[model samples]
Target: MEKDRRSLILDCAKELFATRGYHSTGISDIIEKAQVARGTFYLYFDSKRAVFDVLLESAFETILSSVKPVIVGPTPDRNNILKQLRINLGRALAPLFADRHLARIVVSQAETLDEVAAARMEAFYAALRHYLEESLQEGQEKHVIRQLNTKIVATAAVGMIKGIVWTHATGSESFDYHEVVEEIVEWAAMGIVTR
Candidate 1:
């Protein structure tokens, strides 16, 4: 019951945030939408930022889980895998783009907030970088990618992907998201393929 109520509160808050923006979505709005007492909210989260933190955490976890299988399981050559990579990546990252409130909150507070949000963002980015580095390292060992600095490349790749995500989310559809992702995958693997 407790877990369900907490999840319900989260779901309600996410909806409110998506619809009304984070700054405007008060605890009262959240509780009303959740159909739970105001006091119940305090049991789960201390502040609005805390709720945002939970949402961000879930988004990261979803993205990580979505990408993990494609990276960890045995896969084919880079050329053959680009499509799968793009698809998996699109699905993984598309959520962060789709959830306007979560995306806006994380991106906006990334540099503006004091210790808590800063630390949370830093940890999440570090974990993402670490995952990308490991994936690149394995691809390097398999001769599926270039012998470049995996850390830099991975970080840059993630940054590029995030940029693309932001662009697609905020800008008009100048190009398809799949096209953008495939382009990134292609460029990333081009110089690495051996004869």
Candidate 2:
């Protein structure tokens, strides 16, 4: 079936990209791995960049979808938001962090690619930014915590999470990720003040 073949190409491409790096991985490599002709790949995607877009966007979508309902649902409780973020983060970071080679260059490559990659990355990440902004707005409106700039806080929180992911993916530290995450949530929810 057409759908099955497309999926096959995508899966093969993901593996190749993650392992071989984007620039080093050629179109022929993907076709060879998929056992499909070069023309078949073109039918589904214009270039290697297209496959990268699909992979990155799908990863982002999975994380956003997993967390969207929990953030926007009836409960805007501060504790609930933290809990929901924690739950969804595992789903998002686990696979990506598990791959060292993939994580190293994945985020940075967007800026270096052609116009298509730049636009695709912008759209994907802009939506992510919007989601963060929305969740923070809801939390602030409910007086869940001290009033702060919601957009700034949301973007900062996302930045912190990325830092954690980068550290973990690079094997830079031996600290437990869950503990670091808890510390991150605590810091985000409440300023450090000795009780």
Candidate 3:
């Protein structure tokens, strides 16, 4: 019950933030949207920014948990690797597609909140780029990936994903995230994977 209430508050805050922007969202607004007493909200979160921080952390966890180190065996099957990449992309995107409120906050409002929030967003992206760079370096070393600047590739890939998620979250025209995942994998295969 305690956990559920906390999650409820979080869900409501995410929706409010997505619609209102972080700067415009207030503790009262979250309290009202959550349908919880002001004191109850205080028990869970000290302020609106505190709630936003938790929401941001949760988004990071959801996306990062979907990505894993691609294990390349001595004889790695290219097809299997590509399949895994597709799976990872789908996993990372599924929740975002399901919850556009959270996605909008993550892709759009997160950095604009404040300097601390901006730094947190920056660190999150840096961590993602680091992971991607490391994976690409491993693939190159194992001859699964062609020679390229891993840093630039990682940066571009992260930027592309952010853009796609932003579009999917906020665009007026609807599109399938599954197809987007496949498109991302195919694009990567064409550009990064060795034949």
Candidate 4:
């Protein structure tokens, strides 16, 4: 019963945050939407910021779980590496596609909302960059990719994906996730420098 009520509050808060934007949405709004009393909300979460932080953390965990399988393994041959890259990109975007409103909130609204939010976003990006860097290093060691600066490549790859995903999420028109993943994988696999 207590768990259910807490979850109810979280779900209501997610909906409100997604629809109303964080700054505009009030604690009373979440309380009313959750059908819980003011005291009940406080019992579960001290403030709106607290709840939003939990939501952001939850989203980060979901993304990591989805992408872990593709990135954590022995480096494969060139063909298999490309295949795994496509899968990795696809899984990374799956959660965003599943809850686009949350994606919009995180991508467009979180950074400027508050210091806590901004910090959380920075931590999230750092984790992603670390993962990508490790994967790229493994690829380099196995001769799966050319010798290059793994740190720069990982940062650039993550930035490119973030830019495209943010645009696709916040855009007016829907995008094909599979096609986008294919294009991203292709670009990552094949360098622009003509050999």
Best by TM-score: 3
TM-score of each: 0.74, 0.73, 0.96, 0.86
Tens-digit per-residue lDDT, 1-195, candidate 1: 999999899888877776566777799999888988878999999998798778878877887777753443365555565656677777776776666555655565443456766787777778888987887787777766668888897788778776765555444434465566668767755743432
Model 2 C-alpha lDDT per residue in residues 22-96, reported as the tens digit of each score: 788999999999999988999999988788878777766665665644443564455666777667666666655
Quality of model 1 by C-alpha lDDT: 0.71
Predicted candidate 1, C-alpha RMSD? 3.6
TM-score of 4: 0.86
Better-scoring candidate (lDDT), 2 or 3: 3
The runs of at least 3 residues in candidate 3 whose Cα sits more than 4 Å from the true structure, single-residue gaps closed, are: none
Q: Candidate 4: what lDDT?
A: 0.80
Sort by TM-score, top down from the best: 3, 4, 1, 2
Q: How many clashes does each candidate structure show, in the order listed?
A: 0, 0, 0, 0
**Which residue pairs of candidate 1 clash?**
none
Q: lDDT tens string, model 4, 90-175? A: 88788887777778777877877888789988888888999988877766666666778888988898898788768866776577
Backbone clash pairs for candidate 2 read: none
CA displacement after TM-score superposition, residue 41 of candidate 2 (Å): 3.4
Q: After superposition, how far is residue 52 of candidate 2 from its true place, in Å?
A: 2.4
Q: CA lDDT of each candidate?
A: 0.71, 0.68, 0.89, 0.80
lDDT of 3 by residue, 1-195 (tens): 889889989988888899988878888888888888999998988888789888899889988988878888999789988998988888888888888888899888987777888899999999999999999999999999999999999999999988888887886657687889889999999999999
